[model samples]
Target: MSSNLLEQLRKMTVVVADTGDIQAIAQFKPQDATTNPSLITAAAQMPEYQEIVDQTLLKAKSDLGAGASQEDILTRAFDRLAVAFGLKILEIIPGRVSTEVDARLSYDTEGTIKKAHELIAQYEAAGIAKERILIKIASTWEGIRAAEVLEKEGIHCNLTLLFGIHQAIACAEAGITLISPFVGRILDWYKKDTGRDSYPAAEDPGVLSVTKIYNYYKKFGYKTEVMGASFRNIGEITELAGCDLLTISPQLLTELQGSTTELPRKLDPAKATAMTIEKIAVDKASYDKMHASDRMASEKLDEGIKGFTKALETLEQLLAERLKKLEEKAAVGV
Candidate 1:
């Protein structure tokens, strides 16, 4: 059953492991893998990953000098962690690893662009090719614009935290390499308000959101890839089975591995092309209008941005403590 399901779905979609633990990712043999601030933070706490974090901080201290300021050490250490994770992920997956930039830079076009390049440079320095890296950025209008510049330079991007058609349409217009709509996150917000467990896959609000984005891209011949992400359960995954890609967490990956159900293509570009989709673009005014039009998108965008920012701060704090310890050790001869 596993072999049959793999055969059926392998052609229609790219399977990516959404994890920071390289061991779990290796077990599933996903084509790609992704990591964000939260995953990195969680992984750093694992005893198995203590060496990875310590080594990263030690590298930061050496590169920045033992007396480097905490701010400098923290900034470089974050990069170290991301690169270390990306390198490990690349070793297990045949395709790219999506490493996220600091989410605090979502509204800062120049900062986002600079960090994206820094991430790509880190990968290259680690002996990974640029073609195998996809810098993940929050899908703010600023982020989309930043990605446009990066894409022109041959750096592909994975636009994440995307929750609305407006964001998707703008990303398509910007010619992004990929867009990751949060399927379960969308369903979560809706469920909180409506108090429901399930919806028909086709009519599920979250499902419809991704389907709309997919159809719009297909109808307009946009090359931007649609990768459904942030799923709450297997149902959402099954609902969007034919997405260009799906980044599943380790727990979900394990569930899929254990299940013997038939894997089918639920989202097809050919079928999408048969549906009517309005051609759209987001000029400055329209972007503002859409932001206002979708209350949930606006609120969630800010909330998600804040959540990632807080996590980044926590990670930075952790790196600083480690850096201080390493500095003391170098002085006293550990």
Candidate 2:
């Protein structure tokens, strides 16, 4: 294991595990954990987790009638799955676990607020405190505003899928608990756009994006933590040595733990404060106009929302089928 690298990083950043696999999380021993609808949906379908799905359906049946609306059943399934994952993750990690709001509600302020509260309620019912859970929301201006309100009520938020400085500045002004600027996705966009080798780690666009956010946040004294996410490789990960947090996948975490290389310090608040940066603000209208103008941001935000929504829908369908089969078995006295 990269004990030296780990020591070097532990002095600067908090490492977080980005996965739905509890066992893998335990192996890496990240301080925090994160998961999205897609990861939860994938985990729910695994044979090892069939019992979780069956049990969720079984309980929903007892609380809901066969004719219960799919919306209610799906909500219940999502809550159960998220809480179950959080519960398992809590057993290993010492810090919070970020559970995302329904991606479909990314732009719906009220809906996003309601879902964040609902997820926190589920965790509370499971005996997990609000401090141990972070409701992850999209980095849209509306989402950031919703999270700002939620934070006032003592619910922490993790701004996810963030790609630009505008989103970061908005989240900072909004007083979010943390911001997870996507690292690899931005890299993907640049790679696809340039059709050439990406910039070296020192100049990689994705790494630079997070660095800019980190420096801005630190310089401005924004309490919102900066957590780098969606990394494509260890080079990107190691380059972001001193981010407030880095949510890495298990494979990459394993690689980081296995390597014995020197890890450099790429971010430091004292240094960041000395750099020149412009102060910006994005209100609802400005955010909308900016999002509309940037085809990449607009298209990617839309695509990511759809992808996550579809995964949630697939999980719900599977749960409904399971519920129907169980009901039929009980009715037939089989």
Candidate 3:
């Protein structure tokens, strides 16, 4: 059999599975895995994960007491479910697992920090160390600040929903452990706004955005890792062959594993340093201005947050229905 693109990509970059499905993680055997509300919700519907959902619901009912409100039970259940999935993922991958905070808390720095601590606490309670987990937060200004605080406390963070250089720079400056600069979402915005059918990987705006962020990070000697995320195609993945990491979906992973095409290294720190790009600093005003000026970045950031929020709400609704059923079953027995 010929060599696969995924095996080739692994030679230079860390491959992270971007699904909450444990079976897919096992199939791909990625170095690390990341889970969000959407993924977790989707996986929860599968029969294989229902036991986890049921157990989490039972525990929430017991811990929250009979008088606890439905919202209280659901909030605790979701936390437990997220960590439960992370724990299962940890058993499969030797590397870290990223568990996200609620998207609704993206703009609240203190809320985000509190939630991060809560997640870490849950993982710790389950015998997982802080080093084995990455608290995924949205890359809003507040989220970056929350990550800064979390980093100081020895909690590593993966900043997501990043679309602009301002967000990347702020995240790097905050000493975040990693930043997931979305590639496909950027391309989606550009294609919609410009009415273009498609662009080659080299000129793809999403690819360019990630390459720029990767170069900037390397040029400045920042230790923050740039993880290219939200890939729409194998071309985008191959174009970013030498990124610090790439969190790819299972579908794309399958496509890559089947392809025998040569994957060349497209990003190098040495080459980036030799380039004539000027260094720019971003403060609050400049950060806001730069983010505001980029219509794609601003619109997509908001849209991404809202999309995740909707998925989270759906997950909550599912849990509420399950919890209601469990309560009813118990009542019948009583």
Which runs of model 2 end up more than 4 angstroms from their true locations? 1-4, 332-334
Cα deviation at 316, candidate 3, in Å, is 0.6
Ranking the candidates on TM-score from highest down gives 3, 1, 2
| 1-334 per-residue lDDT for model 2 (tens digits) | 4465665677789999899987788788889999998889878877887887788777765677768786787677777778888888998999999999988899899999998888888889888999999999988777998999999999999998888877888888888999998888888888888896767887888899899889988888898899999988889988999899999898887777677788878899999899898877788777777778876667666767788889888888877777788779889998
What TM-score would each prediction reach against the true structure? Answer: 0.95, 0.94, 0.98
lDDT of each: 0.86, 0.85, 0.94
RMSD of each: 1.6, 1.8, 1.1
Candidate 3: regions farther than 4 A off: none
For model 2, what is the error of residue 242's alpha carbon versus the real structure, in angstroms, after optimal superposition? 0.4
Among residues 3 or more apart in sequence or in different chains, the pairs in candidate 2 whose N, CA or C atoms overlap within 3 Å are none
lDDT of 3 by residue, 130-229 (tens): 9999999999999999999999999999999999999999999889999999999999998998999899999999999999999998988899999999
Question: Residue 287 of candidate 3: its Cα lDDT?
Answer: 92
Model 1 clash pairs are none
Winning candidate number (lDDT)? 3
Best-performing candidate as measured by TM-score: 3
Candidate structures ordered by lDDT, highest first: 3, 1, 2
Q: What lDDT does model 3 reach?
A: 0.94
Cα error, residue 121 of model 2, in Å, equals 1.4
lDDT score, candidate 1? 0.86
Q: Residue 3 of candidate 1: its Cα lDDT?
A: 55
